[model samples]
Each structure stands twice: as C-alpha cells, then as structure tokens.
Target: MMKRYTLMVAGPLVLLGCAGPLTPRDTQQAIRQEVAQAAQPQPAPHAMTDAQAQAALLPPLKLELPKGAAEPAEPRFDLAVNGAPAQDVFMAIVSGTRYSMLVHPEVAGTISANLRNVTVPEAMSAIRELYGYDYTMDGKRIVVRPLTPQTRIFKVNYLAGARVGSSDTRVISGSVSASGTGGASGTTGSGSSQTSLETSKINTTLNSDFWGELKVALETIVGESGKVILSPQSGVVVVRTTPRTMRDVEHFLKATASAVERQVMLEAKILEVQLNDGYQTGINWSVLHNGQHKYSSGANTGNFDLLTGAVSGSLADALGSGLPAAAGTTSGIFGLAFQTKSFAALINFLETQGSVHVLSSPRIAALNNQQAVLKVGTDDFFVTNVSTTSNTGGAGTTTTPSVTLQPFFSGIALDITPQIDEKGRITLHIRPSVSVVTEKIKNIDAGQAGKLTLPLASSAVSETDSVVQVEDGRIVAIGGMMKQSFDDSANRVPGLGRVPLLGYFFGNTSQSSKKSELVILIKPTVIDSQADWQADAEATQARLDKLERQPQTP
Candidate 1:
C-alpha cells in the first residue's frame, strides 16, 4: 500500500513538471502585475541648467582650429564685458600684444559678450555674428569698418572660348528630275514635276557665352548695389558687392569649380563573337551564371552592368534563378553591362560559347563635358566622280578625263562624350562604327582612247549612336551587331578538275555561311583623386611586365 501511494504521488509530480512553471492563472497574474507597475507614476529626471548645456557644447581649451594667415598669434584668454564701448573692447582684446586695432570714424556701437579660452580672431568672429558689426583682418592688425560694399576677385580655371553643338535630321519622300529633247538644228525641252513630301528638324546647343551668363547670374544675386566685371581672356572676375552677397558668390564659385574640373578614365573593348552552331540565336549569358562565377543583376552589391549578361533559355529554368535581362534586344544585337574586377575571367567564360576575337582595346581620359575619340584602321581612296573636258585644236579634238577620288575609312572608330554629376553618375553620348572595305575594278570607255580602268570601293559598315546613363565603374555593352557572309570552296584531283565532263564527277564544291556578332564594352571610371591615376599606371605596368614574360617566336 505504501509503495503504491509513493508511485502515484511521484507520477503526478512528474506530470506537473512537464507542464511548465507558468500555468494559465499564473500567466494572467504576471500580466496583471506588469500592467499595475506600468500604470504607477514615475519620477522625472533632473533638467540641465543653461550653463551645463553651454559647457557640454563648448570646445576644449586646446581646440586646434585652422588659423588663417591674418589670425593674431597670441595666447587664448577669457573675456566678459557688459555694454562696453566697441572701440574699447577691441583695444582691450589686443592689449599688450603685437596686434593693432583700427576703428573707422563712422563705427560707433556698444558690445556685450562673454567668451572663454578663445583666440582673438575667434572672439571677434563670435561677437560679429552675435551683433551687426563688420570687420576685416590684416597681418597683426584688425580693421572695423561700417557695413558697406566690398570688392573681391575670384579666379576661374577655364579656356576662353565658346562651344556649340547641333543635330539635324531630314527626310525627303520624292525625287526632283527634269527631261529635255533636242533636235539637230534646234533644241526643245519639256519638264514635268510630281508632288513631294519634305520634313526637316534641327536642334542647336551653344555653350560659348559662359562669362555673359555668369555675369547675369551674379547681377541677379547682388541686385543694384553690385557690379560684375568678367575678363574671360585672363580667367578673372572682379565683383564689387556687399559682404553678404560676396559670401553667396564664393559658395557658387566653389560648386562650379568642382563640377567643371571633374574627369573620367574610360576603357573600352570591341569584341567579335563567332557563334557555334548550337547558339545561333544569341550568346547564352546564363552559362556564366550557372558556372562557378556569381553574376546577378539584382544583387545588392556593386554595379555589375559592365559584364552585361542576362538569363534566358531552358538552362535558366533548371538553375531556378537568373540575372535580370539587360537593356536592348535579347538576340543578335543587344545591350549588356557588368561591373566586375576581372577582365581575364570574363574572357575565359566567353570562350565556352564561341570563338572570341578582340578587335580593339582602347583607353582614354576625358574631362567633364569633353569628347574623346579612338580610331583604328586604314583609309582607302576610291574613284567617286569623273569629268571629261574637250578642247578644239588645229589638228584634232583633244579630250581629257579627270577622276575624283574619295577616302573611304575602313576600321573601327569610337566617339564618346561624358557628363558627370555630383552623385558620381555618368551620362554618356556614344557613337561606335566598324567598316570593312575592298577594291573592285570599274571599266569606262573613252571615245578614241582604249578602255579606262578605275578602282571602286566596296564596303560593309555597322554603326550606332546612343546616349545612356550609368554609375561610376560600371561597364556598358552594345551587342547584337551581327553580320553574315558566304564563302565558297572546292576540292578535286588536279588533272581531273580541268576535264569538263568528268570534272563534275571528281570535284566537290561547297559553300558555307558564317554569322558573327560584334560586341563593344565600355567602362568609365571617375578620376576623383591622384590615387586613381596611380592605380591605373600600376595596372598598365603590370600588364607590360606580364607580356615581357611570354615567349616570342622569331
């Protein structure tokens, strides 16, 4: 009986422990206690005194302030005065020191200020801000002047010139032609015309009158009492205005200088991708994403647009995730950008899809609002126009033919202009062109002389002009510039190939079509400091060292 009672009691105790310490009634009691405690009144903390707050905000005794050349070189001191003459106060501050104080005849006022452990200039500045006193500092001297106009000269670094840009677009839908008939003895002519549609648009931008615009802006800021004299040739501006207006001018000039002086270093790569048979539609950028490389469009890290790639095709579905599609088309000619540090890695990844060819690698630096161009190739001249002149001579009629040749540029050219803002975003106007030129012979007949031969140029060209905005250090890619070519070839036994009937049986002729895509990648890095230029130089040196290590075949 005893053992049964003990076991029964132990089982109930174990069950209670498993249920936890806080039951429903206990939880409710705890909540009630918390509510009661929160409802009770609480004591407020002590409020700070005026002097305590002042002490908290004041700088320490050894405050290392930037001392201008005009600042007085004397030990700091405390000053407490109540309604004292301004001239006396100034004199008292410089007493026993090498500095001198001069009060203008019109200057008359009473000063009341309390400052501690501050330099003479700091004390004067503090009093000026608190009151409406005007002062100027010379080496070891102070001049108190009445509120009046002041003359200040500002220096601006810019070339003395004007800039102009214009764009024009025109469309004509109809042709203009005239027809005439002539008889042996007399001439008669009849003309007819048809309705034509013509459209014209023109846009012009002028940046030539910078000084004029600046003068107008300054005049508006200073109103009637101010005068602005701009000498663009010398890069100087003289402004006579009130002290308050001068401060505003200083601020405006600072901002303008920073904006105009900014520069960017641009690196570009033009590549040709010959697609493999399986990837004819386009380059499968998903291949890079599925590989060991981590390329994501929506990643929260640095801008990766320099390595423009988008996820597509059935492979992306299998991976369960993909980078967002880039701007422009998904096939042939598309646009992609990436922001990656490794160029070699990107090139290695590209080899999986097709044969890669680097057409051009150009690097240049341009200032804000400046244009840079890079051209690589040759210029060939071909006959474009021909004219014949005849003169009557005693013996016979002499004829002379003149040929006009025009230069055809065959190669790659890139033109780019960059506009950078305070936020480090770059807006670019880019134009890229690629062309291939070949020579063909043209036969022309001269009346008495034999046939005249001239060379004509045959060309295939691809070009695009566009404007885009991107962050600093991001790569911009223009792709899908594709070209198709047909090539013919034959193979046969040397002797059998010449036999007319049997040649067809022995020789094998084949024609193949090739498709290739041109991709241009551009990366612009903002050159904010000397360190950036140093880094670029280091990278160039490293590349040179790497090339020197490679074996050369003589």
Candidate 2:
C-alpha cells in the first residue's frame, strides 16, 4: 500500500519535472488503479524462499545444436548430448523430429541429458528423467508437463500377450448328438441322429491384483469423476483423472515397472580396409634385480579380431610363436573410434594394427536381441546316377544304382543378417545354399545292354552356413569352401611308355592342386554417440565416392 502511494505521487513529480507529460495514457490509468488500491486495506508481500524460487525460476529447455551440421531428412536421430541448458535445446530437437513436442509452463529447469544417439522416444525418455515431468503423444505433438492431480489420461500395458482383449455380444451355439444300435442275432438294426452347435462369447476385464489396486487408488484419488478401465485382450489399463492423481500413479509406475523391465541393445561397425602400414619401432625392456635373482619384462599391445573376439597375430602372439611382430605394419581392416567409450575405443585401437577388411555396411534398424537376415551366396554341382538291372533265372528282377558326385560350378552367393541385443551381443543368421544337378543311366540284365539317359528332376540343395551368437566388438570368422580344382599332364612316347623293361624311357607327369577359402568377417560396434555413427557413415561414403570417381583401365 505504501509503494502504491509512493508510485502515485512519483508519477506526478516526474510530470512536474518534465516540460510535458512523459507518462502515456496507459501509465496514467495504471497510476489511478494504484491510487484506488492504496485506499483499500492490504497485506505486505511475503519474501520468496530458495526452493520456491527454484520452482518459479524453472525455465523451458532449448536444444544446443551442432553449429554447422545439416538437419537430418528423417525425424529419427542418433542424437547425443553431454550438458546443456533446457530453454535453448527443445526447439531444435522438435523441428526436424518426426514427432511434434511441447513443454508445459510447469515443466521448467536445466537438464543434463545423454541420448546416446537414440530415437525420438528414447530421447524423450531421457529428458523426462531430467525433471519429474511426463509426456504423452498420439499422432500429434508430444506434450511434456509436470504431472499433477488435475491432469487426466494415462495408459498401461501388460507384459506380452494379454489374457483379455475386447468385448462384444455373447454367442449361443447349438449342440449335436447321435445314437445307434446293432444286434448280432440276425435281428433288425435301428439308428437315430441329432445335430446341434452352441458357442458363447466370454466378456472379461482386468482381473489381476494390480488391476484391482489401480481401480481402488483411482477411485480414492479422483473421486466419482475419475475412471479406470482394463482391456483383457490387450492387457492395457486406461485411466482418467486429475493431474494430481496422475502424479501419484506416475510415481507408482516408476517404482514398480522397473523390476519387470528388460533392456537390450546392439552395436555394429564395418571393418575398413587398411594397407600394411610400414611402421618401424624399437623394442625396450626393463631389467629388475633383487638380492637373489634378476629378471627382465617386456610388453607390446597389438591385434584384435572383431570376427573372432580373440587377440590373434598380435605382437605378443607373434613373440610367443617365435616371430616378433613389427609395429604399425599390419594388414587388413581398421578405422576411427569417435570417443573413449567401449565400442569406439576398440575401433580406434584396432585401426592402428589389424588385418581385416570391411567390404560394406548395410543400414538397419532393429531392437535389441532381434534377428536380421542376409542372403549372400548360392552354388550348383553336378552328379551322375549309374544303374545296373539283372534278370536271374527266376521271374523277379534286381537293380543296382550308384550316384557319382562331381564338381559342376554353378554360382556363389551369400545371405546373412545379425541381431543385436541390449548387452552388445550379436546373433548372426546366415544361409548359404549349394545347388547340384544329376544325370541318370540305365543298364539292362546280362541278357542285353542298356543305354544312358537324362533323368527327370536332377537337382539337389546343400546348406553349409554356420550360425553363431557373439559378443559385440568381437570378430566372427566363417571359413568353409568345398570347391576345388586339379590338373594333371604327361608328355612322352607311347611305345616307350608301354615297354615294361624299359619303362624308364617314359614321359614325365605334372600335377597341380588348387584350393580356395570363402571367409566372411563381421565386426560390430554398439554405436554410443552420433559422432561415432556419423564417422562410420562418412568413412563408408568417402570410400564409395572415391571408388566411383576412379578411371577404368582397358
């Protein structure tokens, strides 16, 4: 009241000091209101406290964008964040996001969120954790707000398939009955038939103990206006209440749902081709002397097979095999790790020294522990079936058949897909088929000779691919090829070769054997950040572009 009087008197003083009225009409009106308010009895303002101030100072979050990066074409993002203010972060995230988002006035504060390049749903979940705020969305905007008693509308789903789903009219179906009688004394026989069918639909609601608790709690908190419904078939709980009730329910769910939740994820990467880098290094050893004994220690770090997850052909391995490995001189595949995280760290380490090559990486989206399939190769072989039929003195005939398998190269194909689980483990699904053909021949009994003929449907299929589940960042090596080639040649005089006593004058013979291995190397990295994911994409793209621009030689 005193401040209002002071302001009322101060406005006129300001006018008196100035040549003209500086206060606008709106200001004059405001002064009049203050004067009127001053005439009425009023209470003093209360001093604000820290907790209250914190709540009042809660601010809207804003997205801290990557300064010079282009927005993704899709709503999904492999987004990651360390520390940033809320007020400046949300809009940038919402703009290109597939789902619309809104922040309520009550939801205010800075958020320390880490997304790990997760999807929109995952990102929102992380944000929700920053503050005790909840979110809801249908086909439109994701609404974020402080859950309270007055807020309504909530949902819950049962694990797996629900026992009850929907409700409709009950069915009344008829039943069927039949009776028959027979006598063995050559008397008469009698029979009677009756048919009927009956079917009845069963209506159900949430019957679990938790469902009862939820209903009772909703009734208590929301009173008569609130409602809680359970769909048996869907195993979903739909509730309507004030924000206050929702807040309580939210707390309940948070406390209880975690115990039954299971989370899995997968990380993947393609091995980048690297030349044998001619790196030269000197070995250094330290000698330790004790009162009675002296010893030397040496160590070197190198080599990892993502396909096998074993430390193979490293300097240590080489030394153990009596051949010391040279530094920075490994062949095969290698690449960069965007950060110090586990997956990235391993990639970075392997790139420095490894003999693995990544041919390609296909873009895939899958849940943890879900399988993805790939088809890579197919081949064909040839076979011949020889048959001998003999007629003995009796009327019965006997037949002998034999099949000769031969190499008839047809084609090579490969198909494989890997599933990733939350623990960074990978389950690889592979299918490699080999198709072969066969020719048939027929020989009559000893009485007559038979001729060879083409057989109907002379093809066969063979499956040789191995399926394995492995740890993320581990290498899996599949090596098995059954194709082979051989050549034998001899040159000399035929008469000289036929002379047994003088067989030493025969010609010389040359034979050659050829064998090949079909090996597929797979490496996985559970991408933990957009940086690492982007690095993998960029590397793959750069290599592809380079290959495309290369000049072809005749």
Candidate 3:
C-alpha cells in the first residue's frame, strides 16, 4: 500500500514537469526579456597600437570639396567625463579609431564633456572650438598644439601687375578769329591774338595696385610680431600670425577675391532709324514703354522724359549724358533707358518707328574694373596736312609739296569699362563713336590764277562719352544722332536727256530731304561662374549654326 502511494505522488510530479502549449502572455514575457538584454551597454572598443592604427588608416585624400557639400558619415561614440585632462580626453576620443594622437606637454587644461552619439572628428572639433585648443592631422597621426603663432599659406589669384587709368572730358563754346598784317619796307608791324574758353571739364582716374595694397593691409593687421610674405607672381601669400588675426586676414582676402574676380559680358547694337516723315522728332520711346510694344521689364521710368519731349538742363546735360549736342534739343534723346532680357523684342519695337538698319553688332567681355574695346571698320589713310618747301640747289630752285597722311577710322567703335558692386549694380564708362566718309569739295589758294583743288577726306562723326549706372541685363539706349541728306532726281527720255541746254525743258526734277537717327543700345550681363561663360559660348555657337544654315546670297 505504501509503495503504491509513493508511485502515485511521483506520477503527479512527473505530469507537472511535462511541457504544454505556450500562451500569448508567456511569449510576450520572453520577448520583453530578450529586448532588455539587447538594450544593455556594449563593450568598449579596443584601443589600437601605433603600428596597427597606421596600417589600418587610409592615406589622406587631397580633393576639392564641392560647394555646399554635406558632411560625410563617420563612426560615432559616447563620452561622459568630468574634469578630465584635455590630452586624456583627446586620446580617448581617438582611441580604437584609425588615428593615433600626440598631445603637447603644455596641453594641461581640464575638459568636461557629456556627449553621446558623436563622431571622433566632431568631438575633437567641439573641444578645440570651446577650449581654444588647436590641432592638426597627418595621415594617421593627430598633433594637438597650444595656442601659438602658426604659419599658414594663402592663395591670391590675381595678376602680378598694376593698372592706372585716367579719362578727361572737356567742352568749349564759341570761337575767335584774328587777322594780322606784316609789312617790310624799313618798317614792320605784327599783331597776335589768342582766345580760350572751357565751359566744363570732368576728370576720372583710377589706380589699381592690388598687390601693394594687399601687402600693406596684411602688414598692418599682423603688426610687428607677425610676418607677411607676398608673392604676387605666383599668387601666393604666407603669414605667421595668431589664430584670431589669421581669421581676420582670411575674411578680408575672401571678400577681396570675390570682388575682384567678377566679370561681365558687354553686348552692343548700334542701329539707324529712317523716320517716315511723320515721326520726325526721334524714336518714340513712349511707344515702346507704354504703347502696343510694351515689354515686360523691371525698369524705373520716372527718370525718363519720353512724353511731351521736355528738355532738361542745357546742351551740357546732353553732352554729359553721352549724346552729341549737335542733335539739338528738338532731336529728343533723353533718358531712354530700358531694362529687359530679350534683344529680339527691342529690335521689333524699333521697327515700329521707321526703316531700321543695323549699323553694327559688337560683343566683348571685360573683367571687373577692366577696359574692353570693340572696333569694326576700316582705318583709311587720308591726307591731313600739306606743306610747301622751297630749296635752292645747283639744279634749280624748286617747290615741293610735302603731304602727311593720317589714319581715320570710318566705322563704329565702342570703349567700355565696368565696375561691379556687391549689390549687382554695374557702373559703366561708355564711349561710343560712329564715323562715315562724306562727299564734299574743299578749295585751297595756291597764290595763283585759279586755285588748288584737292579731294580732302571729309568725315562726319557722332560720338558721346559718359558714365552711367545700370542693372545687369538692362538695355541702355542713346539716340538723337541724326543725319540729313538731299537727293535730286530727274525724269526724261534718254535721248532727250543727252541735250544739255534743252534737257531742262523736257525733263522734270524732284528734290527730297531724308533724315535718319542713330540709336545705340548696350547690355551688360554678369558672369558669376564658368558655367555662365560656357552657356554664353554655347549660345553663340547656336547662333552661328542658325546663321550658317540660311541660304547664301550672291
């Protein structure tokens, strides 16, 4: 009986020890235990020896980082320290990484940091910025140094040259003439007279001594303790100065480089408009600005007097604005400036005025504060002066006429210099000139019966020089340069026209006066980068392609 009771109790214990189906609550408990085990802190990373670190470290890459590049991913770590030596903290940050550090003996300051999920470089940078600790890294070794004078090299990309520019503009009015008589008969009388009148004059000069100025500025900033070495030929500068002063120097150089490296492309179109008798005053800019050919632009129209044809100031004002005073007040060229990006629209607008003729289309590029010139025409040699020299020789006494020839450019010429400001405004010095050979007769007295008739070169020139401020991609216009011509035509039978005396009776003659105005438009585009330059080149190429595809004319 006793043995049966023992076996029954043992059977119940065995049944209790047997496995059963798992419940949802029991599985949740097991998952919780596993998550708790995973959340525990991981073992510290193993420190590496110098050789091991050097073997594992990658060679430093000398690469140019693109602009606005994001920071690269790095291995992160957690740090919690209080009042630890800076050297020890730095050593700890670089431990287990592919970097070995050497701290200066003077680096004895204490560092307190509680950073988590921070990278090695980030931790070092934070400590340096906060504690003024300077450091430099080699391929696999980092050297921490105390605040001291350090030598740094800088690159200054500028030409090793100086430029000096000067311009003088003067205007004079009226003229004076004097007659002198000298007689030789034992008594001689001579008279001399002179007159000078300058109504106004303007002078502009610029001296750009970049290297000298930079050296002076750097030396001043460095003072006596620091040193500055400049080599403009190679566009390099080396300085030994404190960190704070070095930072200031860097900032100054950055600003200067940005300012000096800017460039601009200048496009000019000089056109002639033949008035259709109705609009004889000038190109009606009001039509372009407010009428049917209204172009979308960010132009300020308050300074322009397009309507009512109001004259401002005097002839001086016209001259100062780079418009020839010969055009007269009735010519109506004043404040006709427009800002737009489309050259086609401007040409279409000009067609509405009269018969449009493109005189010249010139394009050039210039750097900041640099001058660029475009000349498209022929330089013809013309007799400017003639002198008669008499010589008494054994052969005979003869008078020889000595003629001097001078080259006269009879086409279009444009001279421009641009100064760009930080706000994208461009100040331009514009000098545009147009010249054409005119047919005229000149008579000179040769102390003989008839006279000396020489075909002198008579050239009609219209030129203007002025300084103006304009926005980028804006079109500045100068007009009111007018040319007048007279044409006489006769209609008759060919055989009847041959009779000189009676031809007038048989043929009828007609005379007409044709007047035309010249207009100059200039547009400046700022090129901020190489991409902009390449884009312009591509556009020019496309234009050339289109032109080439057109049918050839004989």
How far is each candidate from the true structure, as Cα RMSD in Å? 26.2, 28.3, 25.3
Report the lDDT of model 1 for residue 245.
72
Pick by lDDT: which candidate is best? 3
What TM-score, computed on C-alpha atoms, does each candidate reach?
0.65, 0.31, 0.65
Report the C-alpha displacement of residue 28, candidate 2, in angstroms: 73
lDDT of each: 0.72, 0.46, 0.74
Candidates in descending lDDT order: 3, 1, 2
Tens digits of per-residue lDDT for model 1, 1-554: 99999999999899988896789658756755654454444433876688987888994687688876885456889999999988889889988777789988776688888899988898888987776567889897899875578889999988788666532222345666544443332323233344555543222242546677778888888899889988999999999887667778889888878987899999888888888887676677655554455443432221111123222332223233433343211553334445564566666766776899999999999889876778899999888766555555576656566777899999998887889988998877666788899998988896797898978888887665555566788777666567878999999989998898989888899999887878777889999976687677666655655665789667
Q: How accurate is candidate 3 locally (lDDT)?
A: 0.74
- Give a tens-digit lDDT track for model 2, residues 1-554: 99999999999989888866556656655654654444444433886788887878995587886698775654556554455555445655676656777877765556666555566666766666545556777775777665453433444654443232222223235557565656453333434455544243323232225555556765675577777766645656566765545666667766544422322222333343232332211111111022222211122222233234343332334444322132122222221111123434434434444343443344444333333333333334445333333433355544445555554533333344455555655555443334455554443353444444444334443323334555555544332222344789877777887677676568778897543222234445555544554565555555555664788665
Which of the two candidates, 2 or 3, achieves a greater lDDT against the reference?
Answer: 3
Give the Cα error of residue 118 in candidate 3, in Å: 12
- Candidate 2, 89: how far from true, in Å? 37
